[model samples]
Target: MNESIKTPSVTDEASTPQMKTKCEHHAECMKVIQAILDDQATEAEKDHFRENIDKCIPCIESYNLEKCIKTSLADKIAKKPCPKNILNTIISKINS
Candidate 1:
């Protein structure tokens, strides 16, 4: 009697890279990401984000987190009513 064994495929041994943000410019990265999403970023900021996104995983993660926060806040703002008194208060604070 003869027994045969099948070889495992390369995919069986292959590992996936961890999805993580490794960027050093955590604050700047998040700001850039937010600015991009909001369409408030300048050309220079866009360049910065593009350059660092590939190199820094931490910053990328931070960027994603900031985006999530911004989206959530936008949804919240959409749902809530801005009281006129509160609006006045904010305007007053800004003017002060």
Candidate 2:
């Protein structure tokens, strides 16, 4: 028998406050969002992101919007491979 491991989705994690620290400003929230999306955020940064999402309605909405867009694009790209011509064209442009 095979067992599957379950991981929390971004929405799941964002739905609750994992830490008590409340973010003070929108700019700070945006920075945390960028870090999280870039996968360059430390654990503390991630904690701040989560805390802000829980404490700030604007942050929660922004996180949800970004997450939805990212997930949607990833799903679409996974289902459709880029055409070789377009890929080569992009490579050529980069090399130009």
**Pairs of colliding residues, candidate 1:** 21-57, 21-58, 22-57, 22-58, 23-56, 23-57, 23-58, 23-59
Q: Looking at model 1, report the run of 10 residues with the lowest lDDT sum.
A: 15-24
Q: How accurate is candidate 1 locally (lDDT)?
A: 0.76
> Which candidate has the top score in lDDT?
2
Off by over 4 Å in 1: 1-22, 79-96
Q: Which of the numbered candidates is closest to the native, going by highest TM-score?
A: 2
Question: Which digits, one per residue and each the tens of the lDDT, describe model 2 over residues 53-92?
Answer: 6667778777788878888888887566889999999999
Q: What is the lDDT of residue 64 in candidate 2?
A: 81
- Indicate the residue-level lDDT of 11 in model 1: 77
What's model 2's lDDT at 22? 44
lDDT of 1 by residue, 19-96 (tens): 444555567777778789899999999998787776677876677887898889888875668899999999999999
Worst 10 residues of 2 by lDDT: 16-25
The alpha-carbon deviation from the true structure for residue 31 of candidate 2, after best TM-score superposition, in angstroms, is 2.0
